[model samples]
Target: MDKRLIKRIAIALCVGPLLWVLFLFYCRPVVALHYSARATESIGFFFMIDYATRKQGMEPGETVVIPTPMFPERDLWILLSFPFDSKDSFEIRKPFSRVDVCIGAGAKVERTEIRHGFFDRFTEPREPCEPPTSKR
Candidate 1:
């Protein structure tokens, strides 16, 4: 094979993934989930996007941070629990936005807050999570 072509291929292979990683970090929004366990036993649930299960686990007081590609205005994300499952899924209206939800007993949303980034944690004006009704 040609030497120049091989060099070009190697460079492309290295740069392609680097660009993708940068895009994911800067463009894609992240989810800072905080599931509080009030029940005696740990709660098990499925973290889903558009009805497809992505992650399933039970973390009581610890915050579950997830970097997501779903857009707040475009897609629908939900949390569905087991054992006491409901017909309706608990919707995460603004996954892209900064929100930490407190799931109380019986898979209910206790509270929601729009927090600041890591650097701005101490800043004031902590907004509430109030996603607008989607057209769909």
Candidate 2:
């Protein structure tokens, strides 16, 4: 190849990965959910999105932390949009039924739960009412 062509190719190679790294680092809005299955039944969950569809199953009383994606482009749009929220659905599957809950955007760590009340005895996992407060 000519010297000018080789120089341009080298520059492109160097800049391509740098741009990708910058995009990945600055663009990805890290959102994660931390939850423990307080109910008596097993719990399974997965993001209802086109890109991420892998199910994560947890046993009764098991604690899990999972990262949820808000595609970089969508996140950008979210920032521009009013309320600055991403309407992402998390499908929680219990033994016989499933429930979809919306997780907000830009939440670094959100504590979730599944509770069983007298009327809804493990019939389904409900969205967390609030994070458990620490006494200490």
Candidate 3:
């Protein structure tokens, strides 16, 4: 083979695999394996019921109600046990009370109530203050 032809073929053989790898890293599906695994792990507990009460700095032992995410109409009340934790990956033992209620899409809150019980030790050990009502 000609020298120029041989040189060009060798360069293409080396560079072609590098370009294909670059394209796979940058242009392929953006989802990472770890992200997909994390999302899958959170499938059942995806819905959240974030809420607050109207009173400012309400002391503990006070009752407060928080709204829950939209759920099917089969059951009216949903008892939620929220495990409180400060960090993303930590053991959460404190239980927080939450209820599931129905409301319009634009409603501020989905009318719910707080359930108190022996689990209070887990749910509300100290003075319990609900979060400010959602503004929607």
Candidate 4:
């Protein structure tokens, strides 16, 4: 091989791999972050409120601390808590349903089906009320 041609080939080999690595590390994270944010938005606030109120000991007005995405770049895991409403220390109620978490945008990283603890009776899942049964 010509000396100049060999040098050019060597530089191209090194630079191409380096550029690909950089893109994976940097660009991939940005794409992941955007997808995560969209997923969060799709999970509307109403769902959070419902989860908070349904769990026993969590009053309507209590603050529910929802877990933000751990890695801003990825929306793979989430943690949420519904604290006890009473001034006295009490066992916190688990306020999430596996069905609720599984419902998401087209892409889902983790689908967790969580059940609430003994504080409340398991309510039968209701289909969204439509205008009238006759209409259907």
Candidate 5:
């Protein structure tokens, strides 16, 4: 084998992945205010969008589960927990990892998971907040 060919092969293998990791880290923000996940919003770079949700009037140590706001599909499953209102941000490209994002202010975050068993995954999506009615 030629020395130049071997060196080029090694460089490509190392540099290719390094560039990819960098790209994922520095991607731009893609906002998702709605509670549903949309696949068409991803750019070539990783989904580095900022996501934030808050529920008011919650008890100090109550457990409330809201829909997982749109994150990079690249993640396997998001381990949701309290980031507290003061610290309300998580890494954009990481997946299948524990994210400590804000839930409610001065409220204790107990658990954040699907309210039911695995079958519940197929059920209708509901926002944690009650919708405004004309009468209210």
Candidate 6:
């Protein structure tokens, strides 16, 4: 191999991983806390958006904190966009269902605070809700 080509290959191998790590450190996406509650009948884990904005199904016990993702690039756009760009600065992504996404958003998601209600009777799981498996 040409000596110059070999040097370029060596530099790339050394710098590639460093660049990737820096990218990861500098590009953290925004994620909000999601609380998953034990639904009635133990049917499945139920989660809500806009915490405390709704009154029903919250019950009064422990809630599983699920760190959910925001719109792609929206989380950082607010902090990086020009000061005059109000729309990009304050918009929040609407909530969607993605068990895997919430579980791995690199945020705290292990806390639980949802409890059983006085009139509600259901068997609570001994462990926190696991991320739903993709059927497809």
Best by TM-score: 1
**Tens digit of per-residue lDDT, candidate 3, span 75-131:** 333222222311122111223232222221221122333333423322322321233
**lDDT of each candidate versus the true structure:** 0.55, 0.38, 0.29, 0.31, 0.35, 0.33
TM-score of each model, in listed order: 0.52, 0.32, 0.25, 0.26, 0.26, 0.25
Off by over 4 Å in 2: 1-27, 59-136
Candidate that beats the other on TM-score, 5 or 6, i.e. the better one: 5
Runs in model 5 lying further than 4 Å from the true structure: 28-136
lDDT (C-alpha) at residue 18 in model 4: 99
- Candidate 2, 46-106: lDDT as tens digits: 4343344455654544444332232333322111111222233333323211121223323
Least well predicted 10-residue stretch by lDDT in candidate 4? 28-37
User: Of the candidates shown, which would achieve the greatest lDDT relative to the real structure?
Assistant: 1
Flag regions of model 6 displaced more than 4 Å.
31-136
Candidate 5, pairs of clashing residues: 83-101
Clashes of each: 0, 0, 11, 2, 1, 8
lDDT of 2 at 87: 35
lDDT, model 1: 0.55
Could you give the C-alpha RMSD of every candidate to the true structure, in order shown?
Answer: 10.1, 15.1, 20.3, 15.0, 13.9, 16.3
For model 4 the TM-score comes to 0.26
Residue-level lDDT tens digits of model 5 in 75-125 = 433222223332333233443222222233322232232223333433332
Q: Looking at candidate 6, what is the lDDT of residue 20?
A: 88
Model 2's alpha-carbon lDDT is 0.38
- Descending-lDDT candidate ranking: 1, 2, 5, 6, 4, 3
